[model samples]
Structures are given as C-alpha cells and as structure tokens.
Target: MEISAATMDDALHKALGKIIKSKKAISLDSTKGSNRELVGVQIRISDPRARFSRAISRSQLFSSLGELFWYWGGSNRLDQISYYVKNYRQESEDGLTVPSAYGPRLFALRGKNQIDGIVNLLREKPTTRRAVIQLYDAEDLDSALSPPCTCTLQFLMRQGKLNLFVSMRSNDILFGFPHDVFAFTMIQEIISRRTGVELGEYIHSVGSLHLYANQQSKAQNYLAEGYQEKVPMPAMPEEDPSAAMLVLVRYEREVRLNQTLPAFPCGLADYWLDLARLLAIYKCYKKKDRETIEKLKNKMSASVYEQAISKRAGQIKWQTIRQEPLNFTSQD
Candidate 1:
C-alpha cells in the first residue's frame, strides 16, 4: 500500500497502521514474533523541507545527523557506529573497518568530491535526470557486513524547485524511517539552498517497509502522544557545501574528542552549525556529560535548541534538557 502526507509524521502514522493491520506477516521465529511486513510501500511527503519531527528522540534525531556528517567526511568508523547502535556495525575479514561504508562512497566514491560533481551537474543541466548519487555499490553486498539500506538518491529540478527521490531497498518504518528522513532532507535542503532552488517534494520508495513486532507498543504510544511538527521547511544558507566541508569536518572532530567548544567561531552557517551542535549535544548526552551538553547548549541557536530539547514534553530524556533551556519560545 502507498501513503502520501503533508509531513513525515502523518505518513509514518498511516504507514504504521498499514503494516500493523496487514495479515501477511513475515515467517515467524518463535524467538521473535513475526513482525508485520509490507512490500513496496511508497511514501511521498509534499514538503521534503518540513522534516523536523517532534516525536523523535533528541538522541535519534542527532545520531542520524552525526551519521550523515560522518558519511560526508568520508568516514569508515565502524567503531563509532558500534558505540552508538550497540553492535550493528560490520567489519571486514581484516577486523579493522566496515568494508562498504556509505560516507566514503558518497563523498569519495569516484575518487573525490562527488557531491561537488552533483552540485555542478544540477547547475549545468537543471533538467538532467543523470543527477543521481549512487549509494548501493553492488560489489559490497558479497563482503560487507551491511549493504546500504538506501540504494540511490535522484535529484531533479522542476518549476524552479529541487525535488528528491530516495530509493530504499529496505526500511524499518519505526526505528529507521524518522532518522533517514531528517538526515536526507537536510541534505536535500543544503543542495536546494546552494543551488538557489526552492525545496520541493521528497518521495521515498521502499522495497520492504516494516514494523518490528517487538516495538509495536512503542509505535502506538507515539501515535497516541503525537508531536508538534515544524512546518514550512526552513531555508539553509547559500554557503557552498564544498567550501564548508573542511570546517564541518573540524567541528565533528572537536565534538568527538570531547574538547572544549572552540572559542573561535565555526566557519559553517548558523543553520548548519546549530544542527551539528545538536549532534554534539547528543554524543555528550550519551556519555551523560552534562557539562558538555551545557556548554554546547550555550552556543546553539535558541530556536533549534528548544526544538531539540523541549518537545515531547513527557519524554524522560528531555526533562534534563529543559533545565534552564535556551529560549526558542516561538515553536511555530
């Protein structure tokens, strides 16, 4: 079944109902329940730019941001992924690194700066269908611990706006969907702003869209307690993603090292920098490094700070973030 909605939350809400109500469940493992599965679920969000979902944990939102930046830096840090996900990262026979890392492939797949190549392509030929980012490196499936869930991303410009179509081979609707939308749409916004186009529709086509039977209650709980979505997608800075790559990499490094927030201002735009700091705060949150969260909190944009910390009112994690939080009172 297909679902289309104005926002990701509505699409997910409907998609969850579709799977939960489906009788065509996966073959049961007595050890684990037959998680309901639905094939070929197409979710099209009218505004790819309206990606902020209040229901997602600050941890989930920022971790996805971290992963995207990690990939942007051309990283293959299975060690870092292992620490966050608690053991989903795969290693090669050498036991050193993930064989088919998406970051390296996306940024350095064709030697260096494929992102620049893509930006250039869009500028040179606005209507070109060849503007595709190949994430599925087929060669890795045989050896890599995890092949990419997302196979490719195609960018198109229509009526003066840039739209995106992401093809996913598999999508865990509950756990993975929200994170994927946030990260990819942020990338989408970056490209749109840099290319000087309006943010348009985001169509996500999944081969296997599913809900884990184990997390059924959690899904329902989220549905029952809805979130306040940030509508009308925000516009990112016109800063060249290529020029900003070096600075973005540096900020990530500083955050990972648990160093002091550099006294010198970052070279990134305020929007991008605030996003990065959210991820940094999340890392500190995981470490329960309250001092660091507090430090980074002070540097963050109050609008994003409140969005990251204050929503999902009763969620236990946000309770601490609420103490003397940044004043982004206008959540509209």
Candidate 2:
C-alpha cells in the first residue's frame, strides 16, 4: 500500500498502523535473535524527504549519515564506519572486515564504480533508467554473519526530478525503518544535487516490512507523539557535495585514531567546515570533555548545536541505564 505525507514520521506512523491491520504473524531466527513479527508487508513512503530526520535512536541519524557518506565516497573500511556507527566490527577471515558491509560492492571495487558512475549517468542523461548501485552479494547468503537487508538502490528520473527507489529484502519497521529513511534520503539528496535536478519522491519497496514483538509498544508511543513538530536539516551547499563529505571523513578518521583535529583543508567551504565541526563536537562528547564541547557548541548552527546537546544528554542517559544492574537477575 502507498501512503503520502509531508514528512517521514507521519508516513511511518500510518505504515505501522497498517501493518498492525494487514500483516501476517511469523517468527524468524537470525543472527541478532528470533524475531516474532507481522511479516510480508510492502511500504512506499510517498514523502520520504526529511525535515528533521529521526530514528528510534535519534543519535543514529547523525551516525548513519556519517557512515553512509563515508562509504559512498568509495571507502570500504568498515572499521572507519564502525567507529562512527558504534558497531565495533570483529575482523573476519581472508583479511576482510565487517563481513557483510555493503560499501565495497556499492562502489564496485569488485568490478566498477557503480555509485560514481550513477552520478555521471544522471548528469549526462537525465532520463537514464539504468542508474543503479548494487549492494547485495549472493555469496553472502550462506556465509555472512550479518547479511544485508538492503538489496539495491535504483535512481530514476520522472518528470524532470530525481526520485530514489530502494528495495529491501527485510526490515524491522521500528528500529531499522527510521535509520534507513534517514540515510537513504540523504543519499537521494546528494544524487539530486549532483545531477542538478530537484529532489522527488522516495519509493521504498520491501519484501518484508515488519515490526518485531519487542519494539511494538514503543513504536505505538512514537505514533502518539505525532509528526507535526518539524526540524530542518541543512541541505548540502550548491558546490560539489563530495568536497564536504571528504572533509567530514578526514575529521572522523583523525578523531577515531585519538589524533588531534587537523587544520581545516584549504579550499573547503564553511558549509563543509560547519558539518566537520559538528562531528568534532560529537567527538568531544565521546571523549567526555564537557569543556571542549561547550566551546565547540558555540560555533555550530543553533539548530545543529541544540541537536548535539540533546544527543549528548541521551548518550549519557543510555550509558547510565546500561550501568545499572538488572533488578531480577543481579539480585542473585
């Protein structure tokens, strides 16, 4: 079924409610755990565009964008992405890392640069329908510790606008849906800008869009919170989005290695610098240096500064909750 709305939250709310009405119950055993959920649902988010992108884990919005952008720039190092996204990847056999990370294939390291080529295709022929990036590897079906949910991303030009269409093999609508939209739409925005077309709809066609039993209640609460309140995330400046992404990647690398922030790159615009500074401020929170974070916060956009502070507070709260012993088990 298709649902249209101005923002992603409302569309997601409606989609979840529809799943409750229309989905079949099933259980599937997988790496993370057994998922007891309503299954076999397809969702098309009519307005998948973000105002203030959100995930069940709001912090994930920033982190996933960082990781996806890092990978899109043709870097396949999962450790780099894992550092930002907090996955803590365990090295794999055959000198591989993050066994199923999609970046390497997305850029076509095995064959061709699918993503970069896609940009060129759209730029050269706005009507091209063959602009595709393949992320799924069939060999991983049997061997991967964590198989990819996303199978392919298809970009289409319809009526002079660039639209993003993605097909996923499966999705946990509660925890995964928000982050998926957050990152994919950012991908759409970048491609749209690079192709010099206005951004259009985001069409998501999933084989199974389900809500695990564990997240059902919280998902309902999110619906009750509503989507009228909107926050705007700044769009990439008209200059090459790649330039800004590169700066962000460099800063993330330095922070990950415990190195001091390097001098800003020459010729990089303040648009990119603003984003890099946000990442730096987030690193201050990670280092638990409140003094540094305070000074950095003053340099950020008010909207961005507020988000960084809120996320930092949430991180502290989550860490506190994790430290507390379980009431029933620990008593023994």
Off by over 4 Å in 2: 20-31, 36-59, 87-96, 217-221, 302-305, 313-332
Q: How accurate is candidate 1 locally (lDDT)?
A: 0.69
Candidate 2, after superposition: displacement of residue 274 in Å? 2.8
Worst 10 residues of 2 by lDDT: 323-332
Instruction: Compute each candidate's TM-score over C-alphas.
Output: 0.82, 0.81
* Model 2 TM: 0.81
Using TM-score, give the best candidate's number: 1
Error of 2 at 58 (Å): 3.6
* RMSD of each candidate relative to the true structure: 5.3, 7.7
lDDT of 2 by residue, 1-332 (tens): 56566666666777777766654556676655665554444555555455334433333555655666666656656667666765436434444466666666776657887768999998888888899887777786886465777888999988978888888888777656766777788778888888887778887777777766667677667766665444546656765687667666676676556545444455666666666666666665666655555555566654633664666645543343243221111110
